[model samples]
Target: MNVNKNLLNFLKSQPTSYFAGFNRGIEKEALRIHASGKLATSQHPKGLGSALTHDYITTDYAESLVEFITPVEQNAQTSIQQLLDLHKFAYQNQGEELLWPMSMPCFVGSEDDIEIAKYGTSNIGKMKTLYRQGLKNRYGSYMQAISGVHFNFSFPDSFWQAWASSQGKVANQSSIDEGYLAILRNLKRNLWLLAYLFGASPALCSSFLNGKSTPYPMQKIGKGTLYLPYATALRLSDLGYTNKAQAALNIRYNQLDDYIAGLRHAIRMPSADFASISAKPGDYQQLNQNVLQIENEYYSPVRPKRVTESGEKPTDALERAGIQYIELRALDIDPFNPAGMSVEQVRFLDLLITWCALTDSPDIEREDESIIAENLQQVILYGRKPDLLLEKNSKPIALTQWSTQILAELDDLAKIFDGDTQGVYHQALMAQQAKIENPDLTPSGKIMSHLLEHNLDNGSFGLQLAKQYRNESFERDFHHFTQTQLEQESKDSELRQQSIENADELDFDTFLTQYFGSSLSD
Candidate 1:
């Protein structure tokens, strides 16, 4: 059977089910905050596996920020179960610590309050910590402390072969790369809608500013919270990952080879702004003085990704084979869900991503990034303002109008996905439509309302949920994994770390020299 024949049926004349055999996973991060809502200063819990070698569990920029990664599952429900179970097990093992329930950290007094995650004595482990050290030195520790969820999805090989056949292309690396790159381009074009709908970090602890000055017209709320009247995800605003340093890189997304070349150039290019920092001091503050230490440092809402083997760089992996999947990094932590994302949210993403893959996408020119950045920042800053104007082909259009048009196209996709099930995709689309119609129903709006209605600041509100979720985690029994299995995995990970450390003979400096001088960086 021609599997891809009906993949685009939403836009074609026929009606057929789509998105079968889709593989999806989630990587969620949360700070291990103390009971009073202050970020925990403790090290990564020993019960959770080694942060360096663990496949399913790790830490992010801070030792207190634990990251849970779920294995790819065939459906959303199965994946959700795995995430929920992992959270439950972690809570059972940890003594008094609680996970922060939102994307933005709360009650941070100073940069010194957060601790950088330590990997081990091995060269690879030291490199991981050094990369994070570079992040801390370059961009303040306050920004690195903030975390977000990453959704990874990939179409099965069968779908790709069928899709290639339909497009009259060979089902090879070039064709697969072409298909995923189109998806990446379309995803960047429509990311504003995702922020508008699921953006929950509308407010944050005023202390997050670290006594630094900001240019936004932020007003103070109850007990030291800072927020705008109509902001969505402040996490994506200039206050967060959207920095001006890489704005001039002008990375384009038209071809796979071009994309790899751009990343390689970025790693090799020097930056005057960061040159003052130590490239290789006695303490070794950063990996290098390049614009980017490695390709992973370039932040984007979406990335065309391929899994790499031992010692391979991200770009090298794609250049070697092709894009295995595309990771979407725009989703904020859903404060309401214990897993930071809901099954319905996953279904909506499936529909939207597949829609993007099937739709035609134009190449992103050198100048297009600025336009895209402008639109995304507008939404991040004041997305909920009534009748907000956004750029469409360099002309102004109402955000509501643009959103409605996107939703209308998504409606057809919903129907196609709902052909067999109980119309869950259709239900998800309707829920999103309601958010477009009534901005107050959106996640950001709901969160903001709760804070104002209760006269509570961001920290207080986040703590309330944190306590509630911790109780739920303890009350519910494990369903997906046994306690014995998790503990054994943890012990096994420690053994692996010890083996890696014992095997290294050369000093860290010699190891780093060969790493950069190797063909991987070139």
Candidate 2:
């Protein structure tokens, strides 16, 4: 792949004012654990606000798996501060419970012991819980508990306008959506680079493989830990949150309509396997017998997103307003960072994502999709291996050589990004370059080293880190939001959730019918 010099030059010609207003939001997930290193069997913390209606706090998959969300901000620094404040508020409210610091889960007991997240008595609330139950039935609860970070990003309208002008085209929603889809395609093709650079979950508790055949060769760290020596992110491997049923879907993203059509087809199409689970009125094990319960369930490395209106589905929202932003889902929780990500990491992402958007992105054929997956899998499993190779257009490429090329391109982008303080972007790029040269500097490598040095199992090592974070969180002052504001938000969210419950006019089945009906019509 070669750099698209024309696109790069066009972007470079834009004034620095065009670079303003890069919006970002973060959703960071962490499991709540007990002092004994067991998964916490606790309710959602009261202080953090309602899990369903809160803007900044929620639960994912399980009640104990806490997810902190940040409101969209123009810069990474403010976004990170919001995340830290959320952590502070959550820590204060969660008594005797610590947030598990890694993407891989800590010690888990029997599958039955893991509790599903509960919402109040509204029909929609019941629907949320039932969907999770369905997920538990489809994929085990342990896999659902594996946590990660989602980075939501979008370039400013000014930048898009500049881009359109450069192309001698009108700046319209359709063109913007087309450009974003192109960026999505490019990101999907090159996501393996990110996996190798930032992946942190190379090791996991031995119990994660319980009652199943091991997927790959594993080395024992202690009595209760298993790890791959060169693995970058086991959390992204077949071992975590993977659905074999989805693998056969062959979804495409070259265009918005095609993408929406594929999603609609899957949701409307019935699945015999899920049908067997049951969908009776009171015995609703899942949302429907369809391949997807909701649009959110479709797992992908990246997704185009738009904020939905009242009673609008995610797909409907996208169709209405085009892509407002793209969410990157492949980032693992940075165990070393208290907030799961850093401002420097955010800057690096901004550069890479902008590069992806500005570069030439050809439509990916069905056959080539498998090649992309293979490349990602190779990096996830053996990224640290010096001799490891990755596939580019079905041809072998040295991992280091390809990475060097990317970094060199990034150097040019960095200069364009921060000509005033050239050191800022270059510093981040060099830090990543250091990680490429020295695998020990990588998060997974550091995790492995810590485990070995302390002579602790994965569970023990994670627990220690969680305890350390707990103390640090307590010591740190709130950065962006105050405790009073958090408390008020919690109360307000409770009232909002009740209001939603009160406003429900249709029966659950009737609501589902209307929902899928509108989706299919589109």
Candidate 3:
């Protein structure tokens, strides 16, 4: 079948190193005693905790990575299977129901166990209920059950080429060939899912409620939870909208590169940006005040109400297209390696994108809201469970069986790709099968087993992962940055002199006025 090549090339052109935080190079630290390791704090550990701790960087990357897998599953069967597999795995890794230190609903505990219960099975619910009841009975609070896992995988591009270039691949005259196009399509679907997932934060939702969870304004929508869209910004209490407006101001005509970099830097909240903040042992309040100040000035968003339709705004390419890309925040750094993903995983993502592009997407405005809720619940709760029901179609099917069929269809689409006839969709299929044949082999299950074996605390997983990755990134990045600066000092002449001149002429007031003043000012 013909594919959208422009989108395909755009996806291919994305920097491969962008999502490396998922694989290896995180710092080794003593795991927290009672925390889940994924949360900002461990006070409340049963539900929504894992979802809350994800930082913006991981969320954004995850959302974008999905675009790669979306195209591969053009065949309806492949699409469904890929979706189901992801849902199953995500929930399995994250859906545990113990107190902050002891719960782990996702792990089956042993590789030898037979007939793993389906996600929606009574047993699954039982564990969640236990966690909830345990909390209410013990602490007078209730928690929600959850389904979703955070997975990280990357393969070399060779596997992608093999699949896209396989014999009998279809021919296309588009800027990008059929094979590459297929990969892009898969990525699109991933983008959607990741967006929805990252957006599914209760804290974010709470912001929409004006910081109050009124019983009437928000009826306990249903048993299912909400999943937000990717790249959607939240409104902070102090800052109606955010530095996004400043982001808009920074981008002057003829300065697109510097503008974009500046915006990223401002919003990223690096330590260098707060160099003046002190570390006095007794100045906790002062430290927090400084952090919050920075947050409001650089990290917060401008209220949508304040955003006039005609005003210039900071928009990435995707947002400009009326489609906000997903931000995947739930990925776990693989304990094993420096590279978070392998080429095979990337090819699989390509296949996924193809499926999203080729398959039918529900009309956002026309479709029932309940469809999204049901879809998320079913997928998260019962992924890979035999004879699972699709919320939209209300069809019952076996997830693994469905996944296999999807791969077969994806293989057919592989013919349209450029060179070799082999496909990456097959690898995804094999990976799924491996998990099914040996549930213990699944990444989530392994993580749980290891946690239990090591007696590591819960709630600490996410934070630990973040710290390690951050440390690794800082080590590598700082060294390279220092080297680059050194190199620039030796080679540059005119640019450096110009920079000095510009520094002398810098107008602090002008910078502030441009950033904080009204866009329509005379």
Candidate 4:
């Protein structure tokens, strides 16, 4: 695979300067489990701070499923260290409750056992809860309890400006937005590569199947474990967070305006399926009868985002100000890492995303969109299969052959980053290559081996890992933030939530109308 000459030249021109200031934030979700390895039914721990307003810690779908968010940082090491600090803080406050270590839940009893996360009396709080309620109604609570990690990333303005200048274009928001969208489109087309290399959730508890029949041949490993021998990242598959309604959505990432329009249309168009459920404020099963209650409900492998102002919806923020960052939502929690992710993984992402941005990307046609989806589904379900093939440019290509080509390109990009440092980027590239050569080296492969070696089900293996992580978290020192700082942030977040609740002036209906109203700037 020949490297893009223009991209290489541009990087070579700024050997020490490129990608030095890129920003990144991490959001890691984990289900809280009891000492007995059952899902915890307890409310959000008070010591963790307000779920509605906490900047660092909050509940994702269930009250027992905690999401630890880190502030944006310029370096991967710093961002990862901050996340570790958050885990340490959460472990301290969680008492006997342990954070489930894997992407899949430990031991769920019944659908009703998963408690919806609660916010206080604020209308906004109620709205958040209702959204989760809708998800539970649409997709089961078991699926919602499946936790993962989100990586939010953005190139620095200086880097964008330089790239625009090289392309004989002005370094403005429009150009930057276009560049980001192109990267996103290319990322979508090649996301299967990421899944093949990093996908971790190969096997899950049989409870996850929920008595529904699946087409895949599932072998029972232990008491209740169901798995495909070569499957990788089942969490990214339909078995994870999925919606039948979203499968019909033909959203495209080739253009920013079209992307926003697609989301806006989904939120406004009423869904016959969701319409059956009541939308009355207190009786609301969902936020509304629309295909999407809010823009956030649209599940995608990637999303372009801008930090929103007070009372501004996500779409409104993106329209008012162009894209500020991109969020990669397909990453599964690495059961091997107590922090749910590794700095090496973050470094690999930086290289891949940067490559996406620099490479020339053609606009995806409507027909090709289906191909992209198909390719992704193939990798998610059967990526590690020895003889698996994937469609690239509407032609069949062996998965290994395609992956090998992409990795070779990444190897070139990594050298640019490994300029003076300790070859971190190159090492990450080689590590990924090793996974392609040896399937057992992948996280999902390791998980399967662990299950077979221990003679345990997926749930049992995950529970033991959770216990191990909990012990490790308790013993780890605070790397980035102090306990005092975390405690203060908790208090401050609670106060902030109180202020929002006190300032509520509109009825719930009015607030929803304004939020979903026709106020999109562009």
Candidate 5:
């Protein structure tokens, strides 16, 4: 009868069968293209979007891999294991080529293959390689795949504050959007700890442009630059809506336009909050630039928000207001694995989210941008390293201890899920702890170890990719797979358009204005 009781009841009543883990299946079509030496590449100066569409959306690549290879129901498990299977199948069957979009021209294989310049390595290295190659060949980029799974629980609207307070403190704002924003912000902050969770290759490269010899710090982002793939994680909020239907509707009915107006209306005096007012678009751009310039000039290290050319407008500003979900950009589509992810890993991640939801620490604040940046950098560069410092209770604490505690909380959450054994999350946490004990399992260590083991001079990652390109099954399977997917896309698009038509026929605007007193974001 009480709010908290009702909320818990709602959460309990809802099905817990939501997609919790991801499994990717690679289509034979992608493999066939890789097997042939004619994979496409991108050489775009501004960005790679014009160069590679497939590389932009890894989901398409994953779907292609699973085509005809597995039955529809069996393949659609929405678990990380599926993603791994697809990648393993592609790598084993298809020939590996260092193509554009999926990879960058880096020294990847054995230490012996060091003839090539080792520049441009990001979490996005594989994707960049595929795109770059796709540009040159005019065929298509090699694909990196991804599958996403969400563990969602909802409460009745009235009990949001009770739920928030249960986690420790009430939010500054008690609205649904504010609650979502708080959760998302916490997720983003925690993800900064990814490099510590699962190691990535080390950052070892001279200047990307000049190839000048310099000792670069072993951080996610080095001097004058940060990894763009990491940057992409921040951009996840740009898409605006929760689902494709809502996103499409917003785009169609100019819902965002009205929303923007509503926000402006709510701001009683914009001039009071800011230094100046701007009627012209150019003025607004300049004002944004000025803010960023000031922040960079005064601050020692910034989290690298978007920048613009002298004439270009600030495109990523709206996202700062907070209507986005956290995107996991650090995870790569492992070329060696068939599924893009593992079930254990997904379960572990779910546990992490649950911990975030249940933990009652008011450590994060929107105003504390500086601390957020510092925390993110610390995690990416020195995550899980015993010596690295993390701020807790406004004092420095060893990262290892913090991680251990956080992971312990996750272990408890896994018990609450009752889906898999507790061992699943605990194993990963222990493995990570062991790395802190040993320090060799870090991303940098893995990169170096891979090169040494292969006995190659250079291009260890690149060479591994090249091996995947030439697999026989890849060639045969991918060709058929992509064709089928393209056809499927056409059908889906047609169906989507029909749904749009049906929705459009209704007077949603009138219904909302009369019944709800506000227009939906689309």
Candidate 6:
């Protein structure tokens, strides 16, 4: 429905080789749980490396929540293989702990039990933990405990050059920024489809409710398992990782300058909600009382990101260069997959991302913004519900009907990326189309079916998969990395952390001042 005819025509003429340089990476986070499925109390494994300076593995939100990052690669299979090898290494080093297979965490006891991630004694490291402290105080730790996957995708200079040429535009940083921003907008518009197809979190351990009430109608399966029969990714729902506070900021996404300015305002805007909860750095509850302590605190399903230099804020890096890649933060870790995602999923993402960038995207109007948001919320909470109607063009339409239309365009893209060969891209597209055709084939639907058939709670089901995947991971030999190589990297990381700690010239209070020095003071 949203196609830039000129660019689409241009891409059709160019050989598929022009798009061969597309790069990808994966960063997946999962909680470290014991065999009993309770959150692991152990610190991040010494064998995994320093959370502050490590290239691949790190901690997210909590000490038990481990994040695995794969270096950028051109081939989708290579990136997936790297992710698996990283998992294998982690299994080898993490002792008896198993990575929680689901995005939604269960059996996490009190908020006190969930320790904020420690990044060591470096000034920047302390700042990282304190920012999380702010998140804990503001949104609570349970929200932070939720785990998911981030797919980082970027196109090459040649691909962008071709697009700019077709549009009579120069392929400069500004154009590159616009290209990525367009993908961001369109991705948001279609992200619900992702939640519908790949969302595996249909149910969660009732412990996740924390005895709180939920707006969505839910049913109990086992004694403590709560679920919505039609739900997709509850992690995308309000009860999970919703960004209720950031809604007020109204961050603009149409242009880079406006996006940066919006972030600038949020970082500086004093929040009374946070002010009441926080103490100073020496006895700190949070880094500051601002709306966002740092740009990374702001959440979006899709974000145009740059790899920042040391000590540079994300906005500073963006302003200095341009968007390096777009990170898709919408994915829920598939419980069935050993590595949390499959090659087919990423290949489909390649097709979708390219289509989004090439599609004509205008500035989102206020009403359009609401429609896009509604689509996501509806899909996450009630996607598999038969005859579900989603708002589109300010009117109600069947979810499947719209999905079918989108898939048609994606099929065309698969052909473009695959040429005459029967390739993985087309296969990925077909796989998703099957999900659209058969609701039961969707990850969430399958999860629900297994829960019903086996009479298992979310915790029991998750533990089963976690154990199975752990066994499979151990059996999977490393192709990209070795035990010795990973051990050496971890040791080297410790040295790097020490150097950073030794280089600290100022106390954390002064460090915070300089870090926020460029922002407008409230």
Ranking by TM-score: 6, 2, 4, 1, 5, 3
lDDT of 2 by residue, 399-449 (tens): 888888888888888888776466667788988899888888899888888
> What lDDT score belongs to each candidate, Candidate 1 first?
0.85, 0.85, 0.30, 0.85, 0.35, 0.88
The TM-scores of all predictions, comma-separated, are 0.96, 0.97, 0.37, 0.96, 0.50, 0.98
lDDT of 3 by residue, 1-522 (tens): 344454345334444332231221111111112123222212221211121121110111111011112222223333333432322222222233121111111111122211111112122222222222222222121111111222322223433343334333432222122332233333322332322212112212222232334322222221211112111111111111222234333322122234344444443433333444442333321221121221223321111001113223443331232211222222222332223333444444445544544443333221333454344434333333335444324555454454455555555434334123344445554564565454334443454444446544323343354345434433443211133332333235334334433444324334323432432122
Model 4 gets an lDDT of 0.85
Clashes of each: 0, 0, 102, 0, 96, 0
Cα displacement (angstroms), candidate 2, residue 76, comes to 0.9
Which segments of candidate 2 are over 4 A away from where they belong? 2-7, 13-20, 518-522
Spell out the clash pairs found in candidate 1.
none
Q: For residues 1-522, what per-residue lDDT tens digits would candidate 4 score against the true structure?
A: 223566567776775556667899999999888988888898898899999999899999899999999999987888888988998898899889988888877768788999999998888898899899998887778889989999999987877877787678899999899888988888988889888888998898887777889878888988999887887888887788767579678887778888888888888887888778888866878888888888888888798999999778887888899999999998999888888999999999998998888787888887888898788888888888887899976689998899888878878778778874549898998899899998889998888888889877988888778889889887889988999999999999999999999999999888877776773222
Residue-level lDDT for 298 in candidate 6: 88
Global lDDT of model 2: 0.85
- For model 6, residues 316-365, the per-residue Cα lDDT tens digits are 99999989999999999988788899999998998899889878888876
Give the per-residue lDDT digits (tens) of candidate 5, residues 117-196: 11132212222332222221221111121112222222233335555555455543324444544444456556555545
**Worst ten in a row by lDDT for model 4:** 1-10
Off by over 4 Å in 6: 520-522
Which is the leading candidate under TM-score? 6
Q: Per-residue error at 30 for model 3, in Å? A: 16
Task: State in Å the error of residue 156, model 3.
Answer: 19
Clashes of 4: 0
